[model samples]
Target: MKAWLILLGAMGACAMLTLAYQAGEGVAEHRCEVARAVAKDAARSEAERRDGESAAGTAQLHDNLGTQLPAMEAEAHAATERIRTIYVEAPVSGVCTRPDGVQAELDAARARANAAAARGL
Candidate 1:
């Protein structure tokens, strides 16, 4: 009877040890999975933050362009008019050394003016 009891106790101990080892392995696997999930979440959050910042900057640029567009158009108009006046008055003033260059400049200025006008600037 004593021998039987001792054998039974040994078997139980072995079984407990095996269960403990399996449980430890399961716990380790769960910890690794949690760590990976946390890292993925952190990366996603950082990417979102960067995207939001980029979007905000883009929006600001658009707003700035909207605000300055009228002023820029006015400046372009003034430049075109000035260039046209110069082109017309150059021969009268006798300062036009190169008529071709002057003509090219005038053409560019007129094109710019036409573009701005067409855009309702």
Candidate 2:
């Protein structure tokens, strides 16, 4: 009878240990699933934010193009007119001798051109 009782007690302990291990496994799986779901939600929110910013930028570009196109065209036409006037009002009507101060004049003109180029217009 003593041996039978000892064996029965050992079998019960083994069954309890098995149950505990299965419960731990279930809890671990639940935690992993929850972590995956949270990560997916975070990724979705980030993509949505980027899409919203892109849409806003596109709208702003469209609005600016509507207002700036005409002003840019007018500036271009004015620049063309100024170039034509400069050619028409040139000092010499035909080929002439190089002047004494021609080098200084040429240097000044080059400086002005460089300044304009730097200004992007």
Candidate 3:
């Protein structure tokens, strides 16, 4: 009877661990989706807008995104951060690190690209 009880307890513990891992993965994925969309879209929108504008007419518009892109990127990054997943138990995971960097880089790149486009690049 004692051995049976021990066996049952061990099995329960294993199941719980597996469930926790799966739950963490699922939650992390949701976060990644939002973050990826935000960072990527900022870049994507800028690209589309640049494409819509002639190289000789977009420089000013490129500079203008500064007012708008940050909010979207911040929202996206926040979504990513909602995941409780952690690497090495850090407060922030590596999965989210790229999105954080991407927001700034994408915004800056879009600005340059737009400016260059306006200049007829």
Candidate 4:
């Protein structure tokens, strides 16, 4: 009888521990999802800001909006992609703050290009 009780107790403890671990993992997954959403939001905001800048009444702003913006945006986008690819490597998977900014820059570039196209440029 004592042996049976010990066995049951061990099983109960293990089940509790397993449940706790799963809960922790759930929290971590939620955090990752939140981070991804935040990055996406920031990228969107950057695109909006760049589009606004292109509308500025300045030659340098127009030149940047028409040319340099696209190139810089491309580089930033590449960095974001690289960071994402590296993260999906299984063990250490995630995008950090750095990628967030770069992604935003790229998005802004796209916005600028679309604006220029609209102007028949």
How many clashing residue pairs appear in each of the predictions shown? 0, 0, 3, 0
Q: Which candidate ranks first by TM-score, i.e. highest?
A: 2
**With candidate 3 superimposed using the best TM-score fit, by how many Å does residue 3's alpha carbon deviate from the native?**
0.9
Off by over 4 Å in 3: 55-121
> After best superposition, candidate 1 residue 14: deviation in angstroms?
9.4
| Model 4 C-alpha RMSD to native | 29.0
Give lDDT tens digits, candidate 3, residues 1-121.
9999999999999999999999999999999999999999899999988787776467666766777789889988876666523431243555546545665676688689879999998
TM-score of each: 0.53, 0.55, 0.42, 0.45
Q: What is the alpha-carbon lDDT for the whole of candidate 1?
A: 0.89
Rank list by lDDT: 1, 2, 4, 3
lDDT per residue as tens, model 2, 87-120: 5335454664456787578768878988999999
What candidate 4 gets wrong by more than 4 Å, as runs, is 57-121
Candidates 1 and 2 compared by TM-score, better number: 2
What local distance difference test score does each model get? 0.89, 0.88, 0.78, 0.82
Worst lDDT window (10 residues) for model 1? 87-96
Per-residue lDDT value at 52 in model 2: 100
Per-candidate Cα RMSD to the true structure, in Å, reads 6.1, 8.0, 31.8, 29.0
